[model samples]
Target chain A: MSTAQRRLDIEEVGDVTVARFIDKKILDETNIQIIGNQMFGLVDEDGRKRIVLDFTNVEYLSSAALGKLITMDKKVKAAKGKLRLCCIRPEIYEVFEITRLNKIFDIKKTQEEALEGF
Target chain B: MRAGLVEVGSLVPFQLKRWDPQPCGEPRRPAEPEKSPLEFAQEMTDREQFEIFIPSETAAGQAVQDRIIQRLEARGFTDRDVFGIRLSLEEALVNAIKHGNGMDPSKSVRVCCQIDTETVVVEIEDEGDGFQPEEVPDPTAEENLERPCGRGIMLMRAFMTRVEYSDHGKCVTLEKRRSVEGE
Candidate 1:
């Protein structure tokens, strides 16, 4: 899921939304509380919830981790917001490839370009 | 669940198994059941058990997968079945890496794939405190918005019929049913 570990900074350029999460994963279950609120209470002033995930330090990904992404993407889509991922390791890329998830998410080569695109 | 618990994807018979059975005076059979590398496996990573040890890396996992696939191929496993088995094995190793060892390369995970006439069993053990099932976030739920995790269990459960957590939560034993229609 999107760790409270480091939402680093979030700002929207045009219709794009960008946020960086640093050293999450082990932040414990406390993030569940923070994430639950975002689906509704955390809506932006413009009312669109497009989120671009930047994973620079995150190394490994479990299915559980991927599952959370799916759940969040659902919320964003339901609210007419686009959820995308940027800055992922090649190893993690293999996971998406094996599961054919690469076709499912908006995976970008770089965070800057991803943010700029949205 | 009963039949699905032990599904076998492909059914390739063993052709490469070293055939040296004509030695040592009729091959003295062990009086008891032959024990595998590790006896008891962990239920979950949390209360995970100690089992067979193997390097915790991508290649190591692949090698084990190849061996299993080879053996199954020899036994006449269809290509589709083999792919299913591969998916099961991949999930097991992945679970070991994430839940069992917390994705620490320094640590090694244990794997045991036991096959019999009626069923095929796969076990994966990792080195970590293990986690509880309740700890898993529900991806299908709306509350887990924008998060990533918990899909492995769903995929594995979908690929294989029966998946069990042992060693508290460190190890997982996955069993798929075999089709009686011999190829």
Candidate 2:
């Protein structure tokens, strides 16, 4: 359940844990589980609440990944933490828009923008 | 030694040179070969269909999406169309493996993808007793927005031009039209 072995680049910036997904295609269940477990570890184990996911490199993701994001969002909210996403490619963002998840998550144009409010 | 020609249906004739003796008391019947998913695929001049059988496990859906995208791109599909196809295909495959097949690795999800110039069609069938798609709650509803279970079907319907389910909800067919610029 440790985030250390995940395929995400994790960095701490002013109490905000910014995790950038390194994979271009997060389209499967395994990757989704990995991200979900890692994010859960960050919240439950590490107790780091404020998090930003940088999707600059992610070109595509399946609904399974979206489901994981929703789980993460709910966990963070339950713990009084914040979860935001930034740098989503338009194609991937369209999936969010179609499913109306764009309204649920605090999506920003850049990682700096996401970090600003935290 | 005996030699004979065995012709099975439309398949090529098999020349049997010699028959080996059974190792045990009674002759053991040969186990039936499992039918491949590709055997279900239909080929046409205008469109080509590919069927793959994948285990009900994590990350298996991604491989189906990749192959469909490659075919779509090769057929001159736009990036927008490819994106839509990928998203819808992923959703269908996930539903087949997780919801339909219950993530049992012993169960195999069958996927058939047919592509041509104007549209891409995909069908995913699973081994589980299917549920009614109409019964799935609306994810866009305010109360349901936070819920995660029903959004995959919504995404597939939203992205695909048409979505149909048959075989008591065990099979879903999705279709998406190719996007042309300036239209």
Candidate 3:
């Protein structure tokens, strides 16, 4: 329902909501939906469109999770806000590379880098 | 009048009766043993194969993918190979459950995995009406870059060396050759 109730660990930095994925593996369909909903809630319900997704703790994620990221990116942009992703593991970053999502999203090396100018 | 065992290759054939129940008077033979498609596929492989059937419910695809990844890892696959297999298998299962079965809890998705010395093959099948894989838009295309859907099939093709669809697109088979170092 709410972003706080979901598995994602959300924190606010300035006008941006930095959400950290706490799950080791975010491959399951249910977890994908939960995380997606949490991100969507931030943009739609809470009206906090500027966001940062931290993937430092995530070990693995499915293509469905990638799809969710794309969705969130579009949603945040449509709301006149920005969404940045940072701290993605190398292996996980390969998925984005393969899908060419790295070019579509604003991915940075760290949270501070992603938060800058956001 | 007499019954005799007819061995067909390694399969044990049923004894046929000469007595005919139909107008054709053909020898009454037991129906061929029904073999699941997965069983037939496994029979063709010389190494061990793994398979599981899961409902088209939330998170079921991930559970199956996790089990498959574990098996691949134990078989001495490299991390990159295992990661590719895991990602491809997850995409296939998700497609089977979401696109093929439409996330209907009553429907089920079947996954069969076989690992040989050279390659790992996985087949995923669903119960719903199939779709045309060719019609899926390219996610990498500039026009479609922001689209959330249509990326699963692309990722599956990217991660696996070979990807094929059959049974009217209801079934997808993914194959990844094990790295030379893994062998």
Candidate 4:
């Protein structure tokens, strides 16, 4: 898919790649698939070491999206990289809390915090 | 089950059967009341109920979800309620389409939604061999936390007030009682 169909806005801060999701609702399967491919490419293709996913614009996230994030985390780990998530809204955080994913993923309150100590 | 209320727009007769387990662990059935059918229908005027049948395609599921969200917004459900419902709907519908029907284009999924001032009920049925919910490994377990799949059912149970399965698990019913604004 072309950049026009990209769902994530990628920005590099030093060695870390900060990806911001463009869609407020990450519920569609096709969009989620594209996002998964794009995110995986960050570690698999671009060979980035540190990454932060800023969910500042996201209002809704489905379990499918969470699945992709989990895969991304694994990919980053396999590549000897780090992944952090920040700026998730309260409701979405509750989703993480409910699934006990909060314990596995390094989540921060803001992008600044997620970008720190890398 | 609410007494004397015939489900307004359930396309399948089985959809009318309430599969939600009660506190006593029994399948709850709607109690018959002395009121006439017209009276029961009148009582349900405040509720909106509809059904959508779609091919086992994620796009069709998304359309149904969008329609349900529109209905929830029109019914004045709060943002929190909408978020939970939308998330649960996505999980449930995707499960029906992807897992239940196994993405077989020939298979179909049926979705039924009923919305009222204080509650929303949705049921999705798919054509496939059903599996036991208990058989699903807990996604939150330490051994499974990093696993990519199996969280959809967990999320649905978390977001919905009640999650029930019937017809050998081919059908799932999701219910959410709207939270009062001040609460």
Residue B114 Cα positional deviation in candidate 2, in Å, after optimal superposition: 1.9
Q: Which run of 10 residues does model 3 chain B get worst, by summed lDDT?
A: B1-10
Q: What is the lDDT of residue B88 in candidate 4?
A: 91
Candidate 4, lDDT over the whole model? 0.86
- Clash count for candidate 3 is 0
Clashing pairs in 2: none
Q: What tens-digit string does per-residue lDDT give for candidate 4 at B1-183? A: 344343443422543464232333566766668878676566566766777789998899889999999988988888988899999999999989988999999999988887767798898999989989999999999999988888988988888899988888999989999998977
**Model 1: per-residue lDDT, tens digit, A1-118?**
3443433456666766666554433122234334434433334434668778777666544454555556666777888877778888775676666555676689987887787757
Using lDDT as the measure, which candidate wins? 4
Docking class of 3: medium
| Model 2 C-alpha lDDT per residue in residues B66-144, reported as the tens digit of each score | 7788888888887777777787787788888888999987899988766756777777889999999899888888898
Candidate 1 vs candidate 3, DockQ winner:
3
Candidate with maximal DockQ = 4
Q: Estimate each model's TM-score.
A: 0.45, 0.80, 0.78, 0.87
Question: Which tens-of-lDDT digit does each residue in A39-58 have in candidate 3?
Answer: 78888888987789999898
Scoring each candidate complex against the real one, what DockQ results? 0.17, 0.46, 0.52, 0.81
The runs of at least 3 residues in candidate 2 whose Cα sits more than 4 Å from the true structure, single-residue gaps closed, are: A2-4, B1-44, B58-60
Please list the residue runs of candidate 1 whose C-alpha ends up more than 4 Å from where it truly belongs after superposition.
A1-118, B1-52, B180-183
User: Weakest 10 consecutive residues, lDDT, candidate 4 chain A?
Assistant: A1-10
In the predicted model 4, the residue pairs found to clash are none
lDDT of 1: 0.59
Q: Which pairs, if any, clash in model 3?
A: none
